[model samples]
Target chain A: MEQPHGPQQQRPPSSPPVPPAAGGPAAAAADAPHAAPRAPRRLSRRRLLKLGGLVAAAGGLGLYRCGLYDERLLPPGLRVLGRREAAIAAAVIETVLPPEPPPSPERVRTLLAAIDAYLLGLPAEQVEQLRWLLLGVEHGTFWFGARLERFTRLGARGRTDVLTGWQRSRLGLARAGLRGLVALVFLAHYRDAPAFAAIGYGGPLAPGFAGPPASAARYARLLAPPEREPGW
Target chain B: MIYTAEHVRRDRVLQADLCVIGSGAGGAPVAWEAARHGLRVVVLEAGSYLEPRHFTQIEYDMVQRLYHDGAARTTADRAIHVLQGKGVGGSTLHNLNLCKRLPEEIAAQWFADHGLAPLQGGTLPALFAELEQLLGVSELGPAQANANNRVLERGCRALGWRGGWLRHNRRGCVGAGFCELGCPFDAKQNALKVFIAEAVEAGALVLADTWAERLEHDRRRVRAVEAAVRDPRTGAVRHRVRIEARAVCAAASATGTPALLLRSAVPDPYRLVGSRLFLHPGTAVAGIFAEPIHGWRGIPQSYECTEWLDLGPQSTRRVWIVPSFAHPAGAAATLGAFGAEHARLMRDYAHMAALSPMVHDLVPGRVRPRGRFGVAIEYRLDPSDAAQLRLGLVAAARLLFAAGARRVLVPASPALELAREDEIEPVLGALSLRPHTLDLTSVHPMSGCWMGDDPARACCEATGRYHHLDNLWVADTSLFPGSLGVPPQLTTYALGLHVGRCLLAALG
Candidate 1:
């Protein structure tokens, strides 16, 4: 394969190993480059995240002139998640919750809007990390063996399998990405009253509640307004 | 006169007898007392004034309005998410009202070890009682224990654990479950409603969306507090206000208090300005029960199990187990699964019940400012604290099954769901205690400016006055010598009142 083109892009070994996401140190050992055993204590999630960052940044090398800065290519009104990233999100969320009744088009738009809002709310560095996560997952199809697969090329079944692989993949980076995206989708869907009602939760009881709602008047006598000072 | 910075059109200077910074649980009581005691008080709050009208009760909107960093703040390395309140009322605006006096032994330890005289037996209890009365502290009624809490309550009973209704600082809380989302019902009696109202009523001035830049101080005392009046929404400084006060009380929380002092170049002779910072980091296990639990429906944190609340100075630390429900935003953020499995778990959202297991920290942490843009908290899990969490999680999982949960979803990174009760022990035992393996979060951040008699040992003195400056006092959770296994709002209120009384005495 042509040596990946970028400052930090280097071809990882032919076989990219997979480790279980749980069982902390034991799982992290799978990601180590060499067979030589090292203390798992020294291998931290922060360090692993940093490594993932490097890999993701490198993955975006030839994807676009500026993979992230290429905003003109995106469908209008979409800020952070462009056509490619948004498609990946749509695919991933659908696969995560493939119910008999798939979410409506409006529901999908709402979820994506929530995600965009969340991404916008992120600190600048985190925003880069999330964007990189999206790009890396997409680029994995091309860079990693055909078995690893790209997001666009994968069928619905293939997409689900890839996500499952990531979730179950001993790589902490893949796990973090999957977890974060899942959160964005789940929260956006479930934060509303209909979501609560579907789950059988009676919504927050307030104005109709029998007890005296916390009123400042309760302590009016004790904390009555003090005599105002003469205009100084 | 009270000024909302949203209306600040130009720069202005204000003067007062005392200046209290950050109107949270720590500052409000002091402001209330100061103004009530005939002192001209000026309060500067960095966040906006989120009243019930402003509180939309929507998760996303509420977080943007109430939470510091918009509920997205994480620890320095992004290991643990930190949830703190912002706006005029500070954290009190949105805190789940689980009120507890500082655990007696922790207070006693401070009194004995650090010579925190005011924290001795009756001193704190009296203050606690006074504040409790004023704040309307009461236990959750049977009606208030919704299905989610009922799960925890029943589970504790099944396990023969000592757990029951939690006392909250609320009055007429009509089970408005969105307590963490800034109670739109105006049910939660936070400082924003009680003390702040009293503070304003009693001839005190509260500058909303105003940030204190520096304590203009010299070797002897703080001369004036220089602040910026900014647009609450944009945080763009629209005006400047310099308040000259006889004394200053820093209640800017554990993070903000130290940051302010460091920014102002205040005296730290003992190098103890930002040391001993503590966040009682918590992780919860969610259970999907057969019945619709609707975890987010009622009072969020109205029940706790004290079966394992071991406060003794022993090898094992105390673990406080409680049902901690979340608004969809926070809940979604911590979910460990992705794809169908993620949807599968969330699909049972009405059936999801969660338990937050927390521990008192032995490993003292510190907070450091990263220039002016942000602050980084340095917290490493003490080995025992980690063990306590593991044990607590196990206990919680077992209790869930005992309460008849179909399955339990832990906060584990790779997604751990105990589908069968039999798998609980084996699965829990297999896990190791790495920092990132769990979804770690902290709602309580305590003890950045510890109070003690020894100038060389602690940051603040017995009366909550800073050892370095004569006119500077601290009346916040920053003064706690250590983490309280329970919620610190009540203790925060009591401590603020205690320090306010002391400062009043000194000033007189």
Candidate 2:
């Protein structure tokens, strides 16, 4: 049976055979007639300097094209989603699953940028699908939030009845929207949060709820209202 | 003994009837049994003793300090992750404290086909009793389970998967969710906490920060073992030492043992050495729930589903869904590109539950020796194994959806998210099992330097003695000739105990 490809195949050959020298007896006699005339060597400091400058300029341009520089390289649609939609999504996610003391503005911005970068890197088809999914979520959350506010505005008995009714039909939709919203927010915030801690993940990776200022309670207050707010 | 004023000098040489190479699970119990029988015993360990205080909750640092290859070792062809631990306790130090014994059929096959004595009903029961008493293995109680494990239990029950609480070698665990990192509390009962400690207390000298380089022999009988001592942090060579032994036991795991033998040029013409390797590639399916599951607050993998074990030969599949957690770097790597969307996912961490299916792989691989003492493994899932992976993915997705998952993320390349429960099967069917598309990993790698009934197809005999060498023996998982269809640590330890006894009797 053929062996699976592994390190032995990937490593470069230990040693290559030495090539015959150009001026050896065999080469000199056999190719004497056809050998081209040797070119004269000259030192041109100005030319050398010009060549170095050109190489440096090319290298800088190459780095810029690789998305290493500050300016955005993605298409306008993607750039807009990264810059604007990401922030809005993060804010909305904070409201949906609020952490205590809420994330700082810088933290939220970092989160948005990370998520935007992540989404932008995806295949065009996936990005399109995700965009549609997010749009659906945005619409659902908007309606759900409006309905919730409307019900809260009613008298206590009225609020209770309306909530009980919505629980039957719209609860599933509301839950789905909340999940989408939370996922988007987490993907965004996790990029900026400490490497050990995560919002929704509790695998071997979660840093757990410890450390100094980044208390879970503080994060909750920052993201959502105190009562009935989701805390991760 | 070489000594100066700082070290006591003795011109005397103390000898043992049998000298085991490692003091981990495979070597520890054997040494204990041998020593208990009034045999002079010396157990050599390559790693130092790590106190409970040394165990940290830091992912990067702990993995570097505790895990072999610093947790970056992977198969070359596909990014199949591999993890092993190095230290006084071996892999038990870093493992998730899961214990499982091989099924009766598998044990019987070993006996019938390999000429090893059959581990019959009573024999296996006695072995289990000895193992349980020695390792303190027990099932996790409901009160000891965390919310995440409970969610797994609920999911398995909802899907009617044959699942049950997993037995772990732990005591007084506080649900720290840092088993992979190294439990901060001295709750995990790795070899260091139990066997190695007892061995040391019983006058076994363990040389830490040492590597057994090669085996030296006179004709067929082994004479001495050569090793090097170095600084653990810098890896700078400190000293070279040699221990003359009457016999040497190689318990260096499946990968390490064969590589060591190959490097030493101890000829076994069967070409079966370092072949027939099995890695149970596993993957996790993450589900987003409506409520906080607090997955990190409980036993890492308290419950498991054995529903798929008897899926039959044609199916070539087995799956168990267990609770799992991820550290930040691991989470970030899995989360892919980071930013606002990723951040949002992080915020809802409490509402997430990850279910992993550990599959039984039939496809075999090989481990080749490389540079100095290093090993390179090559493995590829065969067609049947690939089919099993698809089945496993479908099963995992169905269970997650049944457990009230609003959305589930599949770890396939171009990762897809399942929104509705109905989309699970179709999406799973569409997945490509090509190396690039799948995220595969294995914690249990076995059957490399395997034993067989005949000299033509095997590296060693039933007693783990190399066919060509009278005094050389293997006491590690490498001696397993085939897949056990379950975790092999307990079985490895039992085999070690059996072989150690046989070697002593033969010597006498």
Candidate 3:
């Protein structure tokens, strides 16, 4: 039911430019709608990854040297992350998590599986975007750091340095990208049952205890009889 | 009747007197009001209908079910995490149920500057009272304050600062402490339990798992809505749907309303659809206490510190501080650090309570449609707003120290851990407020499709109707002309009711 694809697919209109509020709190100047932010570029992560692939190809390196399908630990049924993407994600997870009490191989595999499930649940476009993010991290050493080696090839110290650089990068895009990946790692790592147990969280309070139920009669008065059909 | 995508086996065309494109605090109230007025209402909810029994209180599963993008949505810059609701009740499903009315000062500004005359002359107060009664809004007493909330109260008393208990819309909350992940006991008097159910009772048809993709409209009036009914689990489109209606209300969130507007390419000559976006962006400050604070066991946020909050246009301080704690998963994400330091913070999860200082920001951001059914949010804090947030952070640290925190954790790159009260100012004051430098999150994103008298300054009329279209209206926080320096749920409900009345009048 989309409108004819032409001008409609173009970038949405940007805010009219305004000078910064002079000598006043933004709370007041917000009415002036001051200091319109720079218009954002409508670049897809997929397109960015393609450009990165092209850059690597132009650097006298073959596609294989750019770390494609290198990590074959793509567990069964994960349709989103490819083998190399999974390897890069695993490396990023290892670098980003706490070093002490190192995660076991089993634990890492579990985390990867959790991440796969989470990614699988997202919209297809977002899954593609996240795949590109993993790929970008794997191949971004030449751009983020001066090193030409892939992220997975780097040792612990080198990988740490590269990730730290991305985290603190002046380019907002780089920081944003790294932050997104790290957030995924943390979300997967900390949302599990063992993590909850480690942090003394009791998980959900239902089944065992429903927590004093709210007034049933009060809500009962508000509901009308169900119609004959539940679907229209 | 409520229908999910599973019930729709084929592409269908339906007709209704009103087609509302969301079912949150905005859309549900309008549907209820309209259905009660004998209008054939059809509500399209892009998410499934989850009952209280369906709420498991599990953080990860609930977030996946209730939140947009599985709770991973961020601004285009990826600096700020934008947490919005996706289910039938929208954010009311997960919100802490804090009920605060729009400040009169901001309303006066809208009236005087934006020509929103209906806001004044005792119109809004009456409407607010009606909504408060419907939702059973009540002020929490000291008895309701948990150990986490007591941190704020004790801090206020120790520092001689201004703070008090907040009002909420829960009737019989047992303090299960998972408000951000849907309520399990159905204690929250939210849109799902109240308005949407009542609307259905009044004969409105709610189509769950139905995504409104476009508004079919001519130059003057919206004639129909085009939608896709998708599988809730896989998001695979099952059937195409079109609902021809006399009126359409986009009660989608602030981000969603504008994205829908731009996606439909409705006649917007002034280019005002998604230009002025405001997120009351906030960051949490965690305090390490000697004793256990079991911060996740009781009512999440009952106390608030308002010493630093001023709603005036030229006010220096505009931070609304409240006790904010998350589950173990959320806490780990909020706490910064990658190595042993991160482990050390997690060990003290049982002894930590946190406070979030939300800025009453004025910096306008932008929202545009990205890929189909995706929202591209472009927002960055201006220097003034950033300064205000920095001050709020400092204030939060001071309050934590005053309440006898052994150490305070400021979520920044290489996170600041101050052990002494004197170290708070010297350490936090020099911190830079940049995109990725600080961890900022927003629960409130508003004012994208704002209302005003002038066409140049507003997308909708003060009556919440689109100025360029006759039968189109917006009923959400997107109608806010400026930042509401307070929780926007009560106001959103009131506006939905107001718009519903206006649309009914127009229909007549």
| The candidate that achieves the highest lDDT relative to the unseen native structure | 3
Clashes of each: 5, 57, 0
Q: What docking grade applies to model 3? A: incorrect
Candidate 2 on B410-469: residue-level lDDT in tens? 765334789988898888897777664555678888888777768888887777788878
Q: Write down the lDDT that model 3 would get.
A: 0.83
The TM-scores, one per candidate, come to 0.82, 0.70, 0.87
Residue pairs with colliding backbones in model 3 are: none
Give me the overall lDDT of model 1: 0.75
lDDT of 2: 0.63
lDDT of each: 0.75, 0.63, 0.83
Give the Cα-based TM-score of candidate 2 against the true structure. Answer: 0.70
Kindly report which residue stretches of model 3 are placed more than 4 angstroms away from their true locations once superposed: A1-74, A141-149, A154-158, A207-232
For candidate 3 chain B, the 10 contiguous residues with the lowest summed lDDT are: B333-342
What is the two-chain DockQ of model 2? 0.05
Please say which candidate is ahead in lDDT: 1 or 3. 3
Q: In TM-score terms, which candidate is top?
A: 3
